[model samples]
Target chain A: MEPFRRLAALACPLVEANIDTDQLIPARFMKESRASGYGRFLLHDLRFDAEGAPIAGFILNDPAAADARILVAGRNFGAGSSREAAVYALVDYGVRCVIAPSFGDIFASNAVNNGLLPAVLEEAAFEALTDWMGGAPAELVVDLEARRIAYGGRDAAFSIPDAWRAKLLNGWDDIALTRQHAAAIETFARERLRAFPWVAPRTDGPRGGAQPRSPDAGETRAGGASPQSSDL
Target chain B: MPATLFDKIWDAHEILRDEEGRSLLWIDRHFVHEGSFHAFDTLAERGLSVARPDLTFGIADHYVPTAGRPRIADPKIAGMVERLAGNAARHGVQLFGLDDPRQGIVHVVGPEQGLTLPGLVMVCGDSHTATHGAFGAVAFGIGASEVAHVLATQTLWQTKPKRMRLVVDGRLAAGVTAKDLALHWIAALGADAGRGYAIEYAGPAVEALSMEARLTLCNLSIEGGARCGMVAPDATTLAALRDRPMGPAGADFDAAAADWAALTTDPDAVFDREVTIDARRIAPTVTWGVSPEEALPIDARVPDPAALVSEEAARQMRGALDYMGLAPGQKLTDVAIDRVFIGSCTNARIEDLRAAAAVLKGRRSRVPGIVSPGSTLVKRQAEAEGLDAVFTEAGLEWRDSGCSMCVGMNGDRVPAGERCASTTNRNFRGRQGPGARTHLMSPAMVAAAAVAGRLTDLRDL
Candidate 1:
């Protein structure tokens, strides 16, 4: 699928600083397969009362804030836990961009890799925007193409490393990237084996012999070679 | 023209530089946990073996079951464990498997076993690898690709990081422990103020802390966007290092101590950024929202979203308020909790357990909770001191050594929509699991919350 690039602005007010990954999707949700809808579970515990009813006083419950999309968070959004599920939850929740005074280092990278726009803005501006959005559908425009955020009578420019941006903008994962470079990688491996013969294991068969079999394909590859290495 | 501790270590480890000017640095040790399985495959695909298996260690954490001895029943998980064992054996790296007596969280085991030491560079796939900085080492977490590189070459290509000095000058107040100080710093510094920095914690407050306390302080360095948090080794460090498994003995002990003592920063060393905190004002803290920095003094009120930085931020605050089910100006203590977790590398030590046990000694908890010992040794020692009985008697489940509910990788998890007061790091929206609300705090504070079945101030309790 082509990457989803439409941007929406969040209408909720600012939360306290240091929103961590644990609170984003929680560890329990990890037990469920990724294919299961993680969206419904997002903020499942935090949004509802003990009786499972939505807390009427919460900002998300206010009708005026409906369709809120952009998230202008307090300082240090995305702390704790290394789960990429937080990114999944945010994206699934329809949050297009997160403008924070700062973000957890690892969490920011995860968000970037997962295609979430984690923008860092000055703290004062973030506070100003929070004051302006009070309980209304404040329009915040996010231009992924230009890496700029516009809203609340102001515009903010940001930067994302081109390498990471390209991955997100194209919806290509690490595996996909490797696949894209497959030919070059194969050539590099062949060349490297020739140059540093000691590093690569020797093969006994003919030069173009049928592709060597891969043993223990389904076996665990934890910290060791596969059990089928004898086949070589 | 200027020399700093960070520069000294960075220079000492530098072997060569790539054409891009990135320094190729030597790695003294590489630690792994269950979560970084992908890195192992990456190394294998490259047709390489661990460069120095003797210096590498593997532990099964992050997903090990906390309440049972049964090799995790989930086939996929079991496969992971088995694969790890096979991988370690094949590579000649020592594996501290789930049932191993020496097994524990990698960070905890490293210090306890004396594997982490002064002037060394430690790397792990887990962000909390900064926990090793208590030993006066340069420690940091690396990406899976970096982990693979370390396994194959025992070296890493690194960019120089900035250095920051967070000096706490005064004595800490009564009831204020290292956990509180870390939370307070994180709260004030906003969790990312030290991004790409190596933080050297100094001054009277840091000097007075024990090695365990220092570990706790350093453990949260990643929370502040720092690669590590380090303290110069002192007499206290020597005392702690002496009894560890790989620690110096006889004449070697004296020699090691001298080297450790010399690792301190020179008096006139400069830092890129400096922030000072008055230790006296620190109080027991607890999280009110999803992040560690979202914390407040135990008695503080929930923050008002209307007071946030931007309308979009305010909007997120609204969503956070909705998710946390909190009202503006509501006292944090009034928030009822369904569970409590007091474990993980953050707060599962004997001291942490003792503090919580003292609080729960004669108290009854209104909520269900778990107190997991960080290691088998810790579990044994706590039971010897009847700490486990104190928790069990207080209605908290005393689990075996494992990561437990801290991240809920194991089966031990709260059901959907349960609010828990946890002593572990991160109170992210659902860190413990889906529909699980976490409020992070100190072990004693978590105990207080458990007893009251709500977010209660430790001092009041």
Candidate 2:
């Protein structure tokens, strides 16, 4: 994980929203391991034709956008079913950020968690940015720290809560976040379990059996229970 | 200090705060389906187990086939099923597995089983989890990681979202159902209109809707970019909640009703943003463009990029129109489709099936298509009432349950380059598959279009 402190303008003129997960990474691509180049399949259904041929009409087909790393989309970008492949696709296709008027809720979460900047801008600002990139290379500076997206020599500020932005910039998931509190959590569990033995698992040697286990062992076993539902 | 309905509910559910200051909101109910096995695996690897599995419930949906075999033969799918059972048993969570009469799509079973109670906060790893919000719950879909978090600790650390009240007044005209209203709202609100907000679909039109109709409204909340969409619970909601497996029993029912009555917003409350739509103005809308919000009435003409406000928009619109095989200025009804698919979380319930069957009873599909029920129960009930016969006789395949052709998760998919009139959400270019153009429509409208072999308006039929 690295601090996202820099701003670089990388723009693609294409504007499309409600881009589903399948289009981000088609179902056929999931057959491959996540360790493989799943990013290559990003926009598999959109960037290529049935025979894996490039569709000239597709926005990604334009020669100018060949190296573009940022995409500007219309309202409601990333709608439909929750498949994380869409983020993989965008990231794999060299897009690190997507600027749109709006994004699907699930899609936005996937983007943030996967370290993709899904910046929501005003409709007019989005349009203006894309319009500026119509002929020349579209440019936008995404400063994760400042929470601003500058385009066309003019910057538009947006806010993504500091915590969420930090998680994305650092590439840390929930597990990483939980690890940060592991020591404190462990102590809290040990203390709470000793005080509330009823909720803790019993470690008493099966009835009156001569089991060679310490009494505190059973106490700690039951005390190990975290304050969360285990599964379903 | 006027609190929006969303904040009121969010505040009520706050259990504690973590060191990072994120509010640990208590989750009243947790829903899961077959696709969430990965989350369970992640938990196992961490030497952790579900702490309060009793609140967790599992249903067999998503990957389950609608027909062919009662049990899946695919080793991976079978393994996933076994994992769900094993996980539920080990964690002490209740599961409604396949063959259980209560087994159905997660979204379908939630309401029918009375598990999605009003004022409760419901979370599922599935996007359509918003379907539970129809009961006036703070229902929303979470990610697999979040799902694991909830399973381990019946709570989620979340920043509270703002609220928006979409008041659709006036009565709906004939042929326009809740599906139509939702589609209209998504189109009018520009698909992402509800972003970062929880939307309460209120007003006379919402209250007048049946429980099933309300579910359809909330099911598409994710499609319109809202965290969740809900309607205030009323007598209709209470009546529907009755007789379900987990519904309130005996005197507990009366107590629950009193609490449910208070779930609604105050007479005068402020919203982060408000958008009003005239119910009467909406018709049996059909999407002609590539996005749900880009839809137009059947009578409306295909949009011309030149007429757009921005050059960027014009270019994108031009591409969408070209990809859709629709020319500018062409009537939406004039667009012919190669196939029709009417099944998905968006519109795959019993009522949706019945509505489509009613339109296709004496008719026949002009193209090859299938009418997949959302679940085994929906398929059984449809067959029990002869809805299957109507579909089969009309040249439409009456397949088994599961999300078929919606996202092409399974083998069922539309061929590339073929245009399809689908009742499922999203009309993004090639959303069905590569080269497969999709046009979103209501179930009845999809049936009408299937019979006509094109995008024909239900009004004309």
Candidate 3:
């Protein structure tokens, strides 16, 4: 993941509230691998019509806003669904920051971890910015180190969880950070098992779990111990 | 200080706490569906293996064909399901594949298989995992990055959400289902009202709800902007858990039930926030616009954007109306629909199926629809009770269990420009399909809409 410090780029406004993940990248587009890149699929349905022609009026489709990398949207932006690809689409499309009044809890987390800044402003402040900018193309400077955004001849502070800011500024991977507490986690697991063994999956209930395909089925392969069968 | 059920659960699961009040809580059960292969990709990228394979369960749902086995005609869709199997097999996680009789939506299969027990932290890759909170669990959804983190560490760092309890008094009026109750509250309070809070449904009305109905309520909590919502364990919860395959049995079950029953919120415990709702006032509600909060009673008309105060709000309302092809002052019942869908984590349990079946019995639908059960077990049981005949005779398709049409990723989708009366939770713009409008309601209400060929009131039917 990229370390986010500061980004100054053209900003586009998506004026609707509750812009959910489905609209970010439709579910159909999620069928392909992420390696294929999702920038083209970002808001595909909203930006295009059934005939696949670009809808001329959509903000993202506007030719002037084509190079925008900062998205300023309505309240509760990125709401609904825990699809991380929504963030991927934005990051892959060169979106460096999303300014909104609020965000879905899961989407906000996904954004931060993927190195996309989900900068939040008060509703009144967001409305003011939208009014000042309207649908016009403008460049906004986002300084993660300073926790401020600069545009329209003035700089304004934005708020993000301090821990998340720390993570992004330092580019700290969550798993690697959590590994420092490995001893505590293992200790808790042992103690928890001793105390509440019944909490585990007791597939031994009346119905009985008779799952097909054993976990150890790999041992039963015929001279296919490794991926070298053809070579042999 | 009196400890709430949430406090107890949090205290028990905390592996470590940081200075910012974020606790690294140990997750007990992790449910994954077809969408989660992305997490597997991340794990491989990081050269990490699943830390606790035994606690993780994989189920095929989002991309599985609803028509029947071997009906996944789209190779891309087939690859999603196949990759889930590949990941599960590679990681040694127990998978309920399509061939398994227990295969279903991850949220439904967890509780159906008794894997969703009280006093545990359950996490899933899909937003509807809150469905498991009905069993007194602290279940919530995570994104693929967090899913990968949890897969690698079996713990999550989260600031403990403030507890908010909605005390709903009075029993629901006849024909008012939990779906209606949830939609009513979400509309009364705006969509973002419950943000940063873990909601607990209390009071007599919540206590009187069936276990399945409680699951339905919690399933829709995310739609209301609450990540986790729960109802305390009672007789209904115990009865739901009894003799299930993934839960404790015999004397152990008895001991577990006693513990679960005692996991209620303490008397005199003050919640961080509290709301009082009169259940009697809730009507059979349906969304009129794209958001869940854009809902009203069945008899109400579409709201005019001109009446809205905020410019931003009015702009959104107008945009939603334009997308939905609805006009202000139009009667909801007069809004005709092209089809109906009756299956999702929100309302696809056995009880949900039975309620829709009761409404559709002998009454052929004027429009086409689909009725997929929550699980294959639910499908077989519904067939045994002749519910399949009810749906088929009414011209609705009888489908095998999966998250069909709800996510719109599979082949099953409401066509472009078509309107559908649905029983799913979220009604976001194009949730069912691009250019497709969705009006969400309860199963019975969906059935009535299918009968009337419009968004008609179930009571009138």
Best by DockQ: 3
Angstrom error of the Cα, residue B213, model 1: value is 1.2
For model 3, how does the per-residue alpha-carbon lDDT over B243-300 read when each residue is reduced to its tens digit?
Answer: 6788888877887877787688889888899999999999999999999999999999
True contacts kept of each: 0.17, 0.22, 0.57
Model 1 alpha-carbon drift over 4 Å, by segment: A1-79, A82-103, A107-232, B307-310
Give per-model TM-scores. Answer: 0.75, 0.84, 0.95
Q: Model 2 chain A: which ten-residue window has the lowest total lDDT?
A: A205-214
Q: Higher lDDT: candidate 1 or 2?
A: 2
Worst 10 residues of 1 chain B by lDDT: B243-252
| Model 2 chain B poorest ten-residue lDDT run | B242-251
Q: How many angstroms is residue A151 displaced in model 3 relative to the true structure, after the best TM-score fit?
A: 1.8
Q: What is the full ranking by lDDT, best candidate first? A: 3, 2, 1
TM-score of 2: 0.84
When candidate 1 is compared with the true two-chain complex, its DockQ is: 0.10
Indicate the worst ten consecutive residues by lDDT in candidate 3 chain B. B377-386
Model 2 over residues B1-461: C-alpha lDDT tens digits?
Answer: 66666677777776556555677666777887766775686788788888557568988766665566576766666665666778887887788776665566788767655667887788998877888889888899887667877776666778767788899999898888888898899877767777788999988988998777898899888878887888888888887765444656555567677767777788778888888888999888888777777787888898888888976578778878887888999888788889999888778877788889889988889998988877655665566456778889999888866666876655577887799999887776656766678888889899989988888888888
Better of 1 and 2 by TM-score: 2
Per-residue alpha-carbon lDDT of model 1 for B213-255, expressed as tens digits?
A: 8888998888777867898878777766654445444565566
